[model samples]
Target chain A: MIFRALIPAFMFAILIVFFWTGLSLDPSKVPSPLIGKPVPAFELPRLSVPEQTLSSEQLQGQVSLFNVWATWCVGCRQEHDMLLAIADENLVPIYGLNYKDEREAALRWLRELGDPYAATAVDADGRVSIDWGVYGAPETFLIDRDGIVRYKHIGPLSAEDWENELRPRIQSLLDNST
Target chain B: MRVLLAALMLLPLAVVAIDQDPPMADPQLQARYEKLSNELRCLVCQNQSIADSTAPLADDLRQQVREMLIAGRSDNEILDYMVERYGDFVRYRPAFNDRTWLLWVGPFAVIAIALVIGVRVVRRGMGEVESD
Candidate 1:
């Protein structure tokens, strides 16, 4: 009799636990389906010099970071210093996908701040970004030596995020490739 | 003459305010495009479907669906393409699978349990009345 009465309470407790666990998780961090798949093919003009095109073929032969950012995105500015620092260390080549921003504004932003990217591509219509399944600005993908995307980080990356998650992943990929 | 001039002045403003792109050439294809767009969730907006969302990402996805349709892809192929890229989260009505089994079955299970409990409680109350 007691066990029968406790059943509803037990079920209610379990439901509460599930709801609590679900609520605690960050909703912004949606897992990318492109992980372990080859980087989507794209041919975009260089942000610095529009006449010269930068294609996905160039991304082959080395582990690299492809960062989708825009001059208008506030989060891109937040993560800019970390990107600059990453570039300084020369750990991996950082390629920028300048997503749907005016040429003058993007150029000025990079000029005023610093150019962290080895080569920045202009995704004028955001077609390439769509191919990469980029829902918003300031998303980063880590591609391996063979051009397979290994990791995807959404939102502005912090210094702690770099040290703990990104750096170690890059190091492990580098170690395995050689 | 003054009213005509005012109407002309308002024309450009009206054009600028109307945001949606013109409908596609093929009516059948356009119908399919609209249906699929309504079904797919806007990742940026979360709540609104791609057809209703004004987000740039939603616009891109809509354009992608149109292109795929033009390329002679079927509705299932287009849906598969989106699901492959964005995961099951892009679908407003998620498929029944391992991850979604509880979501599909939980409501029915709850109802069944409630019915069982109600029967037991009613039977106990009936017994008490008979004893009285």
Candidate 2:
């Protein structure tokens, strides 16, 4: 009787361990093929400059950081200082996608907060952001000279993010530059 | 003239009787509906909340939640109705009660019971001498 009762409990314990272990996994820690692979193609209108356009093709033979941000996103405001610091260093060119934001508001925010982007593209409908696999605003992607995606950050960048994650990746890309 | 006045008085009551359920639109009620749908879990798609899910049952539940909110029902009252009708499984975070205590504590309880039983079984087997 005791053995029978224990058998169900043993099975239940094993099942819980299996499911819990799977849930605790962090996808960011795992290597993504998109990492070190060509950045996906997209074309979008410039946010501030009328009749002008931007595309991933323009990044050929040059490293750049692609940031997806919206005026409505609180997290985007938090990472503004880090982005300005990155731009100050000029370690790599920075590109921006003003995702799902109105033209006037986006331009005004940049003017008020100090624009860090070399050029900003407006993805008003968020189609380009979707292609880039952006689930939310304030995501950043790092691309190498050959137009390969070297890194991806899901949320707002911090000082520690630049030092620990961005800086090292940028260094590796620069080292590999022909 | 007397008959017309009597009919007018009963007309609003008749309309109310036909509309047994509540109205579907009201700004404050809509807000409550949106909040509740997002918080409730889809039973079929355990990973997704009802607001984010495309499942048919989730859609029905969303509409039901909206109806309840529109009826001036409090959050707790709506939740209680669902719990009574569908049991606690409908809730994303099941309440801590006798029936659901198994769900919340099942894993820990299972591990503890297993450890105790395994040790006893091992001790008993060890006590028995093996024949050559």
Candidate 3:
């Protein structure tokens, strides 16, 4: 009789676990399907030099971070100094995908704030951004030397995120380098 | 007086024209475009469908759908393309697959469990009272 009565309690405990896990998860962070997939092929004009393009070919042959940002996106500004600091660390090259911003504004942001990107691609119409599944600014994709995307970080990258989430992934990817 | 009346009559038509998005030439393709838009979720505004959302990303996706339809892509092809880039989260009605199989089957499982419990409860109640 006690065992039978305790069954409901066990079920409730299971339900609580499920609910707690679900509640703790950030709904805004949609898992990227592009994980372990090749970075989308795109060739867009560079923000600094519109004549010459920054293509996906450039990102290959090294582990790098492809960061999507726009001057209008406040989060990009929030993470800008940290990005500069990360570049200073010299662990990996940081590439910028300047999404749908005026060339003048983007150039000015880079000129003023300090350029952290090895090469910045200008996605003027956001078609390239869409191809990369970029719905918001300041999303970062970590790509391997083989050009496969290993991890995607949504929103601003903090020092804590870098220390805990990114450093370990970079280390593992570096370890596996052939 | 006649000119003023004519201008006034045309004002609403002009407003309506300006208010409307330019409809695609082919009605069939236009229908497909609308269908795809409603099916797609706007990632920026998570709750609203791309069709309903005024978010810039939604507008871009809607335009993209129209272009893809015009380019002779099938509905499934367009959906697959979106799913490839944005993942299944872009689909308002998520497809049944490895990640979402439980989501698809869960309600039915709950119903089956409820039925079993209900049947057991009825049987026990019937045991207490004589069955007609």
Q: What DockQ does each candidate score versus the true complex, computed on alpha carbons? A: 0.56, 0.03, 0.70
**Model 2 per-residue lDDT tens digits across residues B1-132:** 999999999898765322133544677786777677766766546677777777554655666677677677898887765554344656777689987787789889989988998999888787774531
Q: What lDDT tens digits, residue by residue, belong to model 1 across residues A1-178?
A: 9997998899899989999999988776778889999999999999998999899999999999999999999999999999999999999999999999999999999999999999999999988887788887799999999999999999998999899889999999999968
Q: How many residue pairs clash in all the candidates, one count each?
A: 0, 0, 0
Over A1-178, each residue of candidate 2 has an lDDT whose tens digit, in order, gives: 9998897899899889989997897533322335666876888889878688898899778888999888998999999989999999999989999987888999999999999999999987655654564545688989888898888887789999999999998998888765
Supply the DockQ value of model 1.
0.56
Q: What is the TM-score of chain B alone in each candidate?
A: 0.79, 0.53, 0.82
Candidate 1: count of backbone clashes, pairs at least 3 residues apart or interchain: 0
Task: Check candidate 1 and list the clashing pairs.
Answer: none
Looking at model 3, the pairs that clash are none
For each candidate, what TM-score against the reference? 0.85, 0.54, 0.92
Between 1 and 2, whose DockQ is larger? Answer: 1
Those runs of model 2 whose alpha carbons end farther than 4 Å from true positions after fitting are A1-33, B1-46, B49-132
CAPRI docking class of candidate 3: medium
CA shift at A176, candidate 3, in angstroms?
Answer: 2.1
lDDT of 2: 0.77
Chain A TM-score compared with the true chain A, each model in order: 0.93, 0.83, 0.97
lDDT of each: 0.91, 0.77, 0.91
Which residue segments of model 3 deviate by more than 4 Å?
A: B1-20
Q: Tell me what TM-score chain A of model 2 achieves.
A: 0.83
